[model samples]
Target: MDRTRFFVRVAAVYALIGAFMGSHMAGGGGLELSAIHAHILVVGWLSMFAFAVYYKLFNIPKNSKLSVIHVWSSFIGVFGLTVGMWLYYTRPIEGMQTFNTIFFIVGGTILLIAFVVFAIMAFVHGKFISEE
Candidate 1:
């Protein structure tokens, strides 16, 4: 029901996953997945968590259409981008790399759109409230 809460929870989950991956590497796991792990931590965990905090701190209405759009677009976009990157680098489908590259591009574009939308929302609504 609460989009901010949902995004925060997703961010927490991503943090756990990223930490686990990092620990696994430190414990001598293969280092080949480092890029994917970094993206997971950065884009998935940090970005989403930041968005959640921004929405909550800014007092954005939960029921606002932009709220919902922000939640779903960020979720889907990050998921696609991260997974596409994982598959692209780790799986290495010979003929499919082109398709994978396109998928990654599309996901990145979507995420960029989400950021632009959020920027618009912030500039449109963000104002210093002076306590009279």
Candidate 2:
């Protein structure tokens, strides 16, 4: 239920995956998934971790409805975007490129909405703490 912790943990997982992919590529595993790997690290690891830091510093309540929504939506967005892109580029299903395009777009849109919601929450609950 700790939203900040949840986001951070998710980011950690993404970090591990990204590192693994980087290693694989360095080992000459081809550059086929380079874009997917980059997005996974940037959007999944960095972005989620940044969100965690924001929530922590902003003192957003873990039990807030907005927190729950942000957590789920962000996770879904990251997963959808990464997986969809991978599938699209890989063409594992032969005729699913259109589906993958839609999937990634929807995912990106969901992520955008989540960020907007987070911005609203931040502005509504944010207060400047003066260091004395």
Highest-TM-score candidate: 2
Tell me how candidate 1 scores on lDDT: 0.82
Model 2 TM = 0.88
The per-prediction CA RMSD against the true structure, in angstroms, equals 2.3, 2.0
Residue-wise lDDT of candidate 1 within 39-123, one digit each (tens)?
9999999999998878766767666677677777888889888888877887676678888887888887778878877877776
Off by over 4 Å in 1: 92-94, 128-132
Per-model clash counts, in order, read 0, 0
Q: In model 1, where is the ten-residue run with the lowest total lDDT?
A: 123-132
TM-scores for every predicted model:
0.86, 0.88
Q: What's the TM for model 1?
A: 0.86
Residue pairs with clashing backbones, model 2: none
